[model samples]
Target: MSEQKFTVGSSITESYRFLADHMPHFFRLIYGPLILWVMVMVGEQILLIEHDIHINSVYFLNVITAAFAIVWYRQFLLGSDYASYRLLIKKGFSNSPLSFKRVSRALLRILVVSLVLLVPTLLLSFSMMVYFHGQGVPLSEAFIQELAFKSTLIIMLVFSPILIRLSLYAAGFALGRTSLRMQDIWKRTRGYTVTLWWVTLRAFLPLSIYSYILTLFLDVMSEKLSINYIVSTIIIETLAGFLTFMILAIVVAANAEAFRILIGVRDGDVPHRDGLKKNTAMPPQTNRRQTSKDIPQKTR
Candidate 1:
């Protein structure tokens, strides 16, 4: 494995490497379906706004996104490896080739897990909404019932993808290289989750700062003689989006590396080879041990 460690995980260079090394076709894997969903949603919204039309297409579209999320999550988990990371970076700059089977598996898992997680959250949201409405209006009313149901369902839909990601991380710890059961994965990851969150917060802070500054600048600039504010806003938005995407990729890559390290431990690769028993794939740790010993001991 490369000794180079990514502190932010999805820094621009690491993100580039992640895609180039692991799955070159990752863009197509994500954006193809995403674009379709966006187009459908945008078109529906446009029609409603432009022509006083009402279409129930939003429900179907949400369903599709949830379905796609399920399939992608499972496949990614099953097929993930260090090789995937390496290949993502070394391959073509313009094209990334990822496996379809892997993609399909990931997507399928996402859908299943999303549903599992969404149910409880949805129920809670619905119950709260209904309780609030009933305090002021009749619970038996048709509109109240309908509002409660629809709001609950949409809340579930919004949460589905987040749930799927959680499930995949859980599943990966259970069956991926680490081979730890779900409970163990949970215990281990729970220890690391705070650290990961901190890192993510740091990664996002830069963008947030940039956005705030840009917005402030825009507010001031807008006050000046007429500016092509729309173009500047678009450019800023694009830059922000790209930066965010790169950061996300880095984060994903770092998690993948962390998982690999945990998997190594699970495979009986001890901190030092001497601590290990019998023949194994793990390399000897003579130099590592020597290096450890040369360090001045702290007076405890």
Candidate 2:
């Protein structure tokens, strides 16, 4: 069957329709890890206690999280049957058991990406230690510097999941299904990503403003000797983040996928319909008529 073509710059409603129409199996491409991460975060927070060992807890958590990511990645890739979009969507998004082999492969990619992101921080820490040792800094001072260095590592570990997920989505869109080169895909998508980022930031502006207002209210309540004001503020932040993510997910994903479709059409991967085709020149046979010239002459 010929592919259906769509024009760019269509309405927001149309964008929604397109996503609804093409509901690929890999739709969980963005949300699976997200749900896992939230659960992990909640569990970790709940388990924090004075009696328990907190030493290197964040580091261990990072390792475990990286493992989870890798496992999922492998499953996603394996289900794609070596990166075919159709197959990937079909198997990866199913309710059946995730392939153990895919999980292994995903873990490897996660480890590689994680290491690439971590190396710089690791080097900085080593350099700091060597420099401080050379200066004969006291043990306590040296320990404090090391703690700060490790804290930086922890921060990177926290944000690494977000970066990895975005990169995977971009890379998948670029290379996985359509067979485009990474560089070419990046060129097509870089601008879209920038635009999405700007729109996303704008979308969060309201939340930020509301957060400030809520903070002020909390402060007032605190001054007035109200209890659990912080709890209310925390709830607001949680709800705001969830709502912001949900709203932006729809807008950004729709627009991004729309652009992808446009790219595909431009490459002749999707064909325009007869009425919608643009070129004006007609074929010689287009206006041909049934003629009776020879028969009429004979009759005459």
Candidate 3:
């Protein structure tokens, strides 16, 4: 297969098309995990409401759900459809173990890249603090605190590009790669930083707003109906979970599409070794069994 290039707009379009076509399969693949997540969330909300105790265990459950979601993305990229619930569970643990090992590895790579880019800002901030303290200025003063806060914002803005560039590690990891290298991702994204950022915004912003509005509307309706707070909360959380999963699927799909394009995989092209069909040109058919009389002859 030849490597294909993509623009930001094209990639966004492709991601939407992929989602539209495979939404049913994608939902089937994720329904179990989504239900589990909703249960966890509802439990947490109930705990907070009834006992006034925040259950930190939900975070662990969230991580598990995230791992499963990553596996789904991996399967999507590999051109797989929804498997049975049992098979999906088995694959999550066996085929793509979304253990701390893989998650931490990817996080560490991103953290290292982020810290390297942030070193200069860190040093400058430290130097400023030291100089201010030497001049009898308290670091806790409002002026110095405001300066630090603004400086932190500036640093975030400056390094945002590097952060965005490395965002594909999730997709890379999902592709069943043994290890992810920051340099490799950087190289792959050489000329597409702006495009990737734009695509991310295009994909994320609307969905986020829609989710928020939907939740708010549901809350208002529940209030008007005089429903129990816990019941309303559970309903809202369930719908919110579905929306969150959908957003996640779309984002992962977009990133996977971009990754595929970067690696020269065309849309609908599966690798031969995967025992999947390839998009190949068909050979012209010839009537090899035709007799000589079947052929048209020219007059002498």
Candidate 4:
């Protein structure tokens, strides 16, 4: 690997372009899993409201939807048109069942990495709880809660780079590069530590802000705006549903695009049944494909 470069702007652009091109297929094949995800989210909220119970069902369901999203992303980028259109006829809309095994393994790895990113937050929260208890403060003490929240946010920001690099496992697995070693990951991703960090922060910081605003908006709607809770719930959950699907879709596309630009795919990546392959191997410096105005979306 030579000196590497990462682009936040073009990758995001390509990601949305990719999503737009596949929007029809997205609605068809993805609606099932997406509905399941939203149902779980709404159910979790209902349980909390009625019984004061909480379940992390949404997170687990995320793995399922993400698995399919990764499959579609890799399929669009690496699959052949014959294999794609042929199956698009037979199977409603998906052309990537061949990658089921790889998607499963990839998602498992991704799940682990995602969980790892929460380690600092979890440990800090736990430690704070213990410290607060020792200080005769309740677990729900407002001061401790605020302190822990701020500290966890700072820690996540600090660890954002690590999250970006580890996210390669998602791309690699989608491309059937499952047995990636850390040195390979580290080497292939050379000179991109800061760039990846910035990309991750830039791509997702708006989401964080939007969520915070939405939370406040809901509060205001119920309190000052005199909105009914059910109406507010419908509005919020509808927006949340769109956010869930959009974010999951973009994440896989961005991961696939970033991997192609930064690390690249070899000649025989994940060959399609029609004998097609992603032939371009981007140099680590990223002068070739990343800066190109147009990336061919279909194999001729």
Tell me which residue pairs clash in candidate 2: 70-106, 70-107, 74-102, 74-106, 75-102, 80-88
What TM-score should be assigned to candidate 1?
0.43
State residue 175's C-alpha deviation in candidate 1, in Å: 13
Between prediction 1 and prediction 2, the one with superior lDDT is 1
lDDT of 2 at 69: 34
Per-residue lDDT of candidate 2, residues 90-133 (tens digit): 45433234588756755675687668667766676667677777
Order of models, best TM-score first: 3, 4, 1, 2
Write candidate 3's Cα lDDT for 117-176 as tens digits. Answer: 568677767888888788998777787767677667777677766777555766655555
TM-score per candidate, in order? 0.43, 0.43, 0.67, 0.64
Residue-wise lDDT of candidate 4 within 93-112, one digit each (tens)?
Answer: 23345456655764686678
Q: What residue pairs are clashing in model 4?
A: none
Query: Superposing every Cα of model 1 onto the true structure, what RMSD results?
Result: 12.1
Question: Which parts of model 3 have CA positions greater than 4 angstroms off?
Answer: 1-3, 56-65, 81-156, 265-300
Q: Which candidate has the top score in TM-score?
A: 3
After superposition, candidate 1 runs with Cα above 4 Å error: 1-104, 137-184, 212-233, 265-300
